[model samples]
Target chain A: MNRYSLNQATTKYWPLEDVVAASAKAELDWIGLWREPVQEYGVERAAKLVADAGLRVSSLCRGGFFTATDDAERRAKIEDNRRAIDEAATLGTDVLVLVSGGLPAGSRDVDGARAMVTDGLAELAPYAGERGVRLAVEPLHPMFCSDRCVVSSLGGALDLAEQFPADQVGVIVDAYHLWWDADVYRQIARAGDRICSYQVSDWIVPLPADNLLGRGMMGDGAIELRRLREACDAAGYDGPVEVEIFNQQLWDAPGQEVFDLAYQRYTEHVA
Target chain B: MNRYSLNQATTKYWPLEDVVAASAKAELDWIGLWREPVQEYGVERAAKLVADAGLRVSSLCRGGFFTATDDAERRAKIEDNRRAIDEAATLGTDVLVLVSGGLPAGSRDVDGARAMVTDGLAELAPYAGERGVRLAVEPLHPMFCSDRCVVSSLGGALDLAEQFPADQVGVIVDAYHLWWDADVYRQIARAGDRICSYQVSDWIVPLPADNLLGRGMMGDGAIELRRLREACDAAGYDGPVEVEIFNQQLWDAPGQEVFDLAYQRYTEHVA
Candidate 1:
């Protein structure tokens, strides 16, 4: 059965191991793991915990951030993504999410930044393909247009994914970021089976204080989740809806409380 | 020739007619008047005042909040637009700025809302066309997707223009709203001669307290103004560079000061 996967970032106040244990405690079917936590607890421990907790590793949190000042640093990011692909494979995660990094520092060339992403993805794709892991390029909000993901539209992601004909290249469409796009449904239809994951959240505040981070939880914001789901469904998209909120206040909440909130809101806001 | 056209909402504190006088005092070449102000002054008085002040109406503030719950109110808005068209004609302003309203109240049907806009545009285009008034559909920021403009991309605007091909159909590629689009340049190029006016302002914050209001003056935000001009130039778009900033703080200052600040920022930022 396709089940709810809480991107542990919702309960990021807790340590990675604890969050995994708590997701297990909450009986969540799957968990989306973040990088820092995996690195802190070590990949072996994270993998062991996922096995013990009976949680499917839905996706390894992130891999890309290819934009950089120099070629060597850019190459280093590619190497890191290769490692991330391996890590996702070890964790039995089918998708390795790629966050195409924002503009290289002091550079206003978005086209150049995108070129770097495509080139980096070219390097990471073969490795990820060999490891049996899908690469899901996530399109963030244009508010992150400067320092975060350069992939701001689903069309841009689709353009990038077109470079790879196989299923290894996919997109992670989040409601929080893409709920406003005029062509989101068309893009989702374009994505089809390549939509590795469907992320849900609401747009609570009109203005986000922190551009890259401040995401609202379900029901608390303006996005009508069921409508978005209807759009995805209308587009013939069937994939796991990952609850990925980056609310600072939600992160500070107790782990169980966060899980309870996510669950409660899931039914009220997301369904 | 470059002309300074003060979009009135940037200084909401001034009443309709007073803004007209102040605009003339500032030696601005043009003024973009909103509907409320004209209604407040009455169409005859509003028309006479601009004529008396020797001011040019660059564009009428707008028409088309087409997404409505009932047909009666929607028809009423169209009726109101007709009056605005008459007023624009009376004031010798041929540019009728049309912002396709946001998703209807208590609705998440963006596509339905957009269809309503295209229909509205189709209905109004012939009338405005006969009157020699070109309706410039302004594609607002993605943030306005909920309660403001549904047309969030330049491509979306171009598509509308294509759908209703007329000398009357054009676009207002406001930099603050469109600076972040991945295909902004391409879409602008596509707009070509259909590009009626180019507006400039900076996005000071991602989401201000008043999302509809609170625009940053050019140079205050991250957008590279010169680069935008270069892109527009490359696309063969040579039209009036309308300085349209909706900053509450700037509006609060004296009217002449507002123009002074706008002019100063334009020269400094666009330099």
Candidate 2:
């Protein structure tokens, strides 16, 4: 209960103020936020609202999508990441999650796209570090490797993160994205101090047509959530366990109900 | 053209005899077989049909689904694999590709399920070797990791394969499954002599509702098909380059049309 955080995305329709009020009423110590809603509500005001409610922002939703064919587009994405870093600092959170962009349109050069991620990170890591923000590379599930995040494994994320100082760049271990890997436990051990955030969700089957909404609630699917959480704990990641599910059903439900259900599942399956 | 093999799954509705006759007409040296269709047509007759058409069976579609909660069910699956080995031998193909079953029903113990795969392989490898059939572990994409194949990466498949005699058990290098892996090239190099069959299919975005049929044809998606084929060749595999795509569109098309298009794409994008 002390370490539980309800990521705002789980209840997608929940207003920023409503989520903050709910978290405060629930006596939750942390809440995870997304950039759009934070910016819409005003970053400083959102930060003050959470602080006034005695809650901290676990992380800012995202900051990377650096893969681009055009030089201007690539530069703009990096610049956007710079702004994202500033937003994370403004919101009083140290971690900014990154979903490295997929291959450029009509491109088959995965290695080239990955190289662009490296270049983007190289340019942003120092800037992020200076502002007390850690860029957390969130390796999406390999299914999303083609259209969403090119970083599809924790090992791959660590490969990118290892190029920079641990404080500047780290990896996010989301159970939904990584529970499939046989090497996960070993990689979690390897992650050690580079683990910036630990997210919990289950791997449900027969993914939605739009598979981006395919994540299941913590206790309803196949992931060993508590085991992964314990592994992160053993690896020295003593941080908030954010409940970050992207399911359409949860989004359509009442926000308070979804938040309560997520917290309950977090206790049963993740804590 | 000298190395191309049409996996029967690519032409799902084509009768076994028609596929063999078509391969013969196409001057193809190889054709991959699926067990159910061969069994339906009678294995010996299908074998003779393929041999009569002068098309050697490059590999068998599958021979694994070993995860089972019940001990008796597990034993039956192992026995079924033995029959599959004999079937592969009768078809005169040494490679028997295996899609290790997903986690058992209502089970979250992935490691436990994986142990079942390891144990299943151990029991069947010797039997397969005796029949001159090398069990080829095909690592399905990570999306299939939950409900299709618990062995989700070439590295993970190789981990299981390395525990057995290389002649008895090897890994399949399927481009669609391994393409998204950042460490895939390194893993392919490590596969060396353990490589059994090389399969090609493209990774397309907006995966269909049934992602099992989400594979796109060569030159139609994001995979670097020729590069992967070359990697297999560099790893000392001089076997048939099998085009194994499972797509609803291809299945609905005329068999001859699909076959010819596949060959054209093979020459342009894979060969």
Candidate 3:
């Protein structure tokens, strides 16, 4: 149906209610939201607002940041993920996004961290599965390989997924991250039905300073979106294509203006 | 013995003969050379000069840009690799560095290109193995992901290595491309004596416009060199810690001055 979901981090400077209101006005059927906004206006209040607006929660923005030098921090992250899963379940969202954490502090050991992630995921898998929410490991761009997700490829994510039960693990292929990967096509095919969600954004060359929020909107960058969507279709994916940008500039604009521009761009490019 | 090899491309602007003389005068036991010098001076002449100077060739600079749309073009690359192996044999180099090609013309499919690389490598392995030369896949920076090697992570390179015979496949883990990776230690361990070569360079933050050549000389950038070297040590890697700087400013300096500064920096920080 070419359904669209706006990930609120795209314009996170705006309040959750404002974003929800904008989505409802735009007639977007779904939304991918961050924990920060959900917390700001209590989750209870956020829930009521979503229901009031008649928007489906596509997936939670994220949960996993599992890498840690010590056991205590890792445990804390696991507990946080448990809370995130509960939130997703409460929201009736089918998926909880997981960003595999980057390297631990003062430690150059990545495999150990990856092992730690696998252990953490395996421990958390049962709880997520029991709640009917799958863990969607989102492979971040390789530029973030050290400080962000260690699982930087769809193939790497799928390889990790293979270690657990199919019902328990899947992946979120963020276009901003996956677009630059030369192996995206075959990996997406290999991901096949395990793809829990698909996202849309652009890989802005000469990435803006303050990179965490510098993501460009779809069609503003060089991503081959239709081809990616086609790959998703070729591999039996029929989920909502979410517009999840993290642009500071967009957040400064009026919500109505941002959504209209995003919707138009999504239709022309990503949809 | 803690020996060093000057990769000629580190001072790429210099003439082949001059670069060779500089390496020899610097008292470096070995040198990693490129194809251009050989092409300019003829392989026999270049080989004789390095031999007369009593310097060993640690490895040849490169062999593959195998990714391409045309079938015959791919075949020609394979044939070129064979010639590179022959050149390696004549120059007494033990390895040939291979940069995985970028996206083929008008193509955004990375997996297909990777498959082409894997197939091409499988074909090239036997020829290289027969000549006592090994193919060392050097994963470039993530910026080159769309246009360079599909194997971005050390683990990705390791996975590729697993496909071929023990002596035939290995990787070159450069500090510049991999310093940010959390999995560096574990991947090096898994690389397990499969690490045929190690290249050293530093990453400059606020990347320059000509990112390709604007590398930071060691001690000028953010990498924790000793720890990474320690990981390489723990992984049973006894290969030469080759310095392969690609900085435009450094390139402009006289060859001897660059080598003197490089050795001092390596000893102080990386050794």
Tell me how each candidate scores on DockQ against the true complex: 0.40, 0.89, 0.20
Residue B263 in candidate 1, Cα distance off native in Å = 3.0
Tell me the spans in candidate 3 whose CA falls farther than 4 Å from its real position. A122-132, A159-169, A179-194, A208-224, A230-237, A247-258, A268-270, B1-3, B11-22, B35-49, B60-100, B104-138, B148-198, B201-241, B247-271
lDDT score for residue B270 of model 1 = 69
Error of 3 at B19 (Å): 5.1
* Model 1 vs. true fold: TM: 0.87
Residue pairs of candidate 2 with colliding backbone atoms: none
Q: Which ten residues in a row have the lowest lDDT in candidate 3 chain A?
A: A205-214
lDDT of 1 at B167: 80
Per-model C-alpha RMSD: 3.3, 0.9, 5.3
Judging by TM-score against the true structure, name the best candidate.
2
Q: Candidate 1 chain B TM?
A: 0.91
Q: Each prediction's Cα lDDT score?
A: 0.79, 0.93, 0.81
B-chain TM-score of model 3: 0.96
Residue-level lDDT tens digits of model 2 in A129-182: 999999999999998887878899999999999999999999999999999999
Model 1 chain A scores worst on lDDT over the 10 consecutive residues at A205-214
lDDT of 2 by residue, B1-271 (tens): 4789999999999888788988899899999999999999999988899998988999998989999989999999999998999999999999999999999999999899889999999999999999999999999998888798999999999999999999999999999999999999999999999998889888888899998999999999999989988988898989899999999999999999999999999999988
Backbone clashes in candidate 3 total 6
Which candidate comes out best when scored by lDDT? 2
Q: DockQ score of candidate 2?
A: 0.89
lDDT pick, better of 1 and 3: 3
Native-interface RMSD of candidate 1: 2.6
